[model samples]
Target: MTTARGDSPADETGGLTRVLVADDQALVRAGFVALLDAQDDIEVVGEADNGEEAVRLTRQLIPDVVLMDIRMPILDGLGATRTIAGEPGLAGVRVVILTTFELDEYVFEALRSGATGFLVKHTEPADLLRAIRVVAAGDALLSPGVTRRLVAQFASHAKQPASGADLAELTDRERDVMTLVAEGLTNAEIAGRLYLSPATARTHVSRILLKLGARDRTQLVVIAYESGLVRPGWQ
Candidate 1:
């Protein structure tokens, strides 16, 4: 799990992280691999030219991060991400989508489909690496510019009542937790807001996730907004 530099998986796994590059373009995939591999701690475990292959390798390798390209020849990154995130065996295989168009609609769908985050294809190498590391640790990477735009888009287009009102199943404390989550507060921050311990906040978030059938905080945010619980100017 270490790189050729003798950096152990823990060093890179926490500091460096393992990555899987899935891009239809050979050159882009190769370039990403090279960039990631050059880092002292990172290890590139596998590559995929299409979504199906990406899903197959992800289950097999269980990489810490997947750099999934938005556009592809067969199944696109969104479909592949859905498949990967939906799979039970690769629970911690976070996906960071690679995009060509800035602020594209597919980007939002990718988030809904369970991508931990995304990066513009031309993103700075350091930023991309940091995103991989963040997502690998189970935190979401919400690019501010993209996040604002996406939130605005969701506000405008999240017209359909969510598929179901799983929220009705939540307790009062869970509702409060969901609101804070939708407002973009992390676990510790939510703990501070509610005057509860971090452990309590994490437990509430977990219960909300299970009860509401959400994939992650990103989806919870969507549910909060779409439900009209978290208003535009409230936070």
Candidate 2:
């Protein structure tokens, strides 16, 4: 069931970021809602006890971000993510996986399933706030070294790279930017390393995402490894 967070979906017309929290644990969900609701720039519009309701509320509320639990009844997080991703109407909605286990195998799958970020339940409140903003602003929450390690670990076992997953579609500079992205470097860091302007680096990333038909930077990282554009521990 979906619980309206007191604020109707229409209340999100302001600049405040609308967020939906989905978790099976009542206390945890309340904690997240309380923390997020306290933020001036954020608003918790709805809450769900499972992934199915999460997707339902997502479609109904059209929130900017969804904090989804990986383990849920009816539909798991990954399944929910895939469904949301498959819907063209939900393109603006970014799902961030919330897990107690940082390296859960499904975390990588969640990314491939169209989740743009992953966060452990123990993440600091400040970091959690930053993550929602970042993901909402069109960047992925894959900056954590654990994210890189997790992607690399599963990429090794990933089935043969998808057909046409090669980097031939990318220009030389785009390839460089993709490598830095796979290394967990942000736009600023990539610009610093590549000696390009931050805006230019961001442009390159956007182009990469478009040309490769990737959902976001997280998929670009997965492609870099799975397509052999980058290898594990190659730095």
lDDT of each: 0.76, 0.86
Number of the predicted model whose lDDT against the real structure is largest: 2
- TM-scores of all predicted structures: 0.84, 0.92
Q: What's model 2's overall lDDT?
A: 0.86
Give stretches of model 2 more than 4 Å off: 5-12, 160-164
lDDT, candidate 2, 1-235, per-residue tens: 5686654456635698899999988999999999999999998889999889998888888899999999999899889998998798888888899999887789888887788879999999998999999988886444558888888889888755522455898999999999999998989999999999999999999999888888778888888888888888887
Cα deviation of 129, candidate 1, in Å: 1.2
Steric clash pairs (candidate 2): none
What is the RMSD, in Å, between candidate 1 and the native fold over all Cα?
4.4
RMSD in angstroms between candidate 2 and the native structure over all alpha carbons:
2.0
- Report the C-alpha lDDT of model 1 over 7-51, residue by residue, as the tens digit: 333333554577888998898888898998898778887788888
